[model samples]
Target: MASRSFAEEDFSCPVCCDIFINPVLLSCSHSFCSSCIQRVWRNKTLKECPVCRTTSSNDHPPVNLALRNLCESFQQERKPKSGPGVCSVHNETIKLFCLDDQQPVCVVCRDSRKHTNHRFCPVDEAVADNKEILKASLERLQEELRRSVNREQKLCKTAGDIKVHAQDTETQIKDEFKELRQFLDDEEAARITALREEEEKRSQRMKEKIEETSKQISSLTITIRDIEEQMKTEDVSFLQNVKATLQRFVFVSVLLNSNHHS
Candidate 1:
């Protein structure tokens, strides 16, 4: 059995939504009309796939020769036969367009009872006028596409900028925290050093005071022992030395008072 013929959609270009014309293939495996892709990329900075939105590395993609040949063959196969342009009712060549019916009719059909009050114009003239209207419509659509592409580009750029800003802000925060940490560490070290110095100074002063107090205690102990020894002496000898002993006792009392004050 013969295989079924390929559908029209197989030869269609995604960009033009029509039969491929001079199709070009991107590295991403998508194909579009060369003119259509060029027009899409004309006002853009980066080249991208229209359907998938994939970024393309190549500015000028290679021609899809196999696809282009298929498109050409499909167009040839769908072309209207020459005799089909004749009107079936009048069996005449269709040269006029019925404005009311909006269909092509032969010269005889233009005056038929069915089209008595219908407006008519030459097929060529009507085709030209309609072509102009279609051209205008196509231009409007293209303009709308350009605007949409511009908006997409702006949105993409904004997203990239936002990402960059977030990264920079994060880096800045980390740096600031690092500096703060360093400052805190330095302050802590400085306070600890000051405390240690103060401790050393106070410890030395305490040691000196203890040594002086110890020397005073030793002197008082010697004076006490001498007094006790003199108390054991005979009463007559003790009476004779009592004046000198009293003077010595008065001197020792003064020393004790001074040590107490210090």
Candidate 2:
């Protein structure tokens, strides 16, 4: 079997240019994160997708399982905290839950969601559950590391392995260092990519908030200007009417007094 090098951190959803999540491919063969497409469609109000420029709709194709597997491997290799934190089976929050058989369930377990009405405890009520799951995961990772170390030790067990009589030990050391360096390089690059994606998500959410705030500010400003203009117009009309009435009254009184004197 070919050892496929997953380019999980390399690919991005074309529309978002960020790490792929729930990726969906367009007819144009361009793929974008599903949420990214929905967001762009809602905001842009355009028929064509931002990336493919092909006519788009709210319809989402089934998520790519290959992409999902790649993501899982990437997370395993990188070991970052930002990996998907939701439960796979229960599809609920796995906070303070167990990892053993049929695990990471929610408080309202009622597992089988259809058949058995199994009772479950609140996540907080079972503190040990959380610790056990964490320990299991840590153990698994440590075991894998140990296995890799054993494999390298075997490779260094013989003189033929290094193919050098005098500097065989030094050659083995170089190989070991090279392997460690490669592992570190992969991990650091993946971590850098994960961090960048997380930052983009945070920045995107903040920008949406800023946009909404700006719209409200603009709306309030317009409303205030409109009210002020209406008040000014009414004031001008009221003063002109008062002046005209006073002039007419004065003229009539003067005429009446003059006629009386004559």
Candidate 3:
């Protein structure tokens, strides 16, 4: 019964102001009872719809089989339920609905001065119209939600891409600096090795020169001792060794000069 109450309004036709009987679909997608529409056309000069000024292209519109089936289902659910089914304000049956204030009214309330100029519709018609508006709003809200989700997803993807690119750039920079540092280290090592090799060569040459000079000094000292000993032997011994001693002295002096120039 509750389902029927909620859905019963959707099956009502605007014409005849009641539930549809053999509902037909117009080109404008509005549904009306076939018999009701035919009667409306019977006395009309222009073949236009009563709700909208749209002209009817076909005299007999196609039957709204889907709507008919839905109406049938609603009717099956409309079994009587236990209720007083009367208005508390006027103690009358709640039949009419106030369109202006969106409230149900009894016949006495409908005739009241408060609703004198207000538009009125059957309870079912009002319910159906309100339901359609609600359905449209629901669809719009769902579309908006979908768009928001898509926007969020796009932003998330972009953020992820930015992070990835940043990491890649950071890695590349590290790799480039690492290569530069390695090159500098290799260059420094090569320079240090060259310096060491040069120093060793110079030191080795200096040592060899010092050893040669020491050998020359030792030989000169021995020659000087022999000459001195010969001098003490008298004029005959001195003459015999003098030539060899002078020759050795001359050779030592020449070697000393050569070492000083080098």
Candidate 4:
């Protein structure tokens, strides 16, 4: 009795304050009844160990088979009474489960008219079958979840690629515009240089033409003065000067006509 008491104290689940039922092991090596742990963490966002408060990294922790076996062995040694779990209606031990009604029923209820044409199974068998169905469903849900995550990742990568492509296109456009602007600037500089050179050439030609016209005017004035001084002298001197003055006048008339044509 003393050993049994000690074992009960050691094996009792912390959450339920009872012997472990379907114990599961966490990463921290702590053990608890599956139902008790689920209840503690139910509707919670973060999964954590109830005893140590350590966060669990795994979505589903493994079952503690050794601990479960120990709990079963301990219960068997304790020799639980059959009457405590008996059906109140039939006054018999509940050994079978009603598949249609989804409840436990005694042998009398199984044969009764209320359960007519209904499927039935032993309690242990029903538990095992239900567990299998639940496990298969869980696997299907997990597969769907994994597919959703993969799709999300692919979409993110595609979006990133599109952004990078857009940036590259923008840079190319800017570079092309820069080249165009530089070409325009260089063309403007060349045109301005050509215009300045043409202006300088035109100005130099005008200066040369002005100097030549001034020299022609000075020569004409000197010829006129010589003719006037000779006219004041005697008739023979005036006649000799008249021939030179006529030649000078003809030369000045030809120069003025040439200048007008130019």
Against the true structure, whose lDDT is highest?
1
The sequence of per-residue lDDT tens digits that candidate 4 reaches over residues 100-216 is 876667887888656889999887676565545434434443444354355445655655555566556556655655667666767655655655565556556655555555555
Which residue pairs come into collision in candidate 2?
A: none
lDDT tens digits, residue span 1-262, model 2:
0114645435556665545778776666666677877777775655476755788554565566676556556555454332233434234445533323323354424343222444445444443443344344334434433543454345444323223432454454456556677557676556556655655665566555445434433433443343333334322232223233334434533643453354
Clashes of 2: 0
Positional deviation of 171 in candidate 4, in angstroms? 1.5
Q: Under the 3 Å rule for N, CA and C atoms, how many clashes does model 3 have?
A: 0
Reference-based lDDT, each prediction: 0.65, 0.47, 0.63, 0.64
Tens digits of per-residue lDDT for model 3 on 1-262? Answer: 3353555567778876656778999998898999888988997777778789688998999999988887766655553331234554345667777777666677878886558799887765654554454344344434443543554456556555555665565566556556677557676556556655655665566556555545654554565555546445433233334445555656755765675566
| Order by lDDT, highest first | 1, 4, 3, 2
| Ten contiguous residues with the weakest lDDT in model 1 | 234-243
Q: Which stretches of candidate 4 lie over 4 Å from their true place?
A: 1-93, 181-262
State the displacement of the C-alpha of residue 33, model 3, in Å, after optimal TM-score superposition. 47
Best of the two (2, 3) by TM-score:
3
For model 1 the local lDDT of residue 158 reads 55
Q: Model 4: which ten-residue window has the lowest total lDDT? A: 234-243
Tens digit per residue, CA lDDT, model 1, 1-262: 0012787677777865656889999989999989989989998998999999898999999999988887776665454332446665435777777778767778878776468899988766765654454344344434443543554456556555555665565566556556677557676556556655655665566556556555654555565555556555543233334446556656755765675567
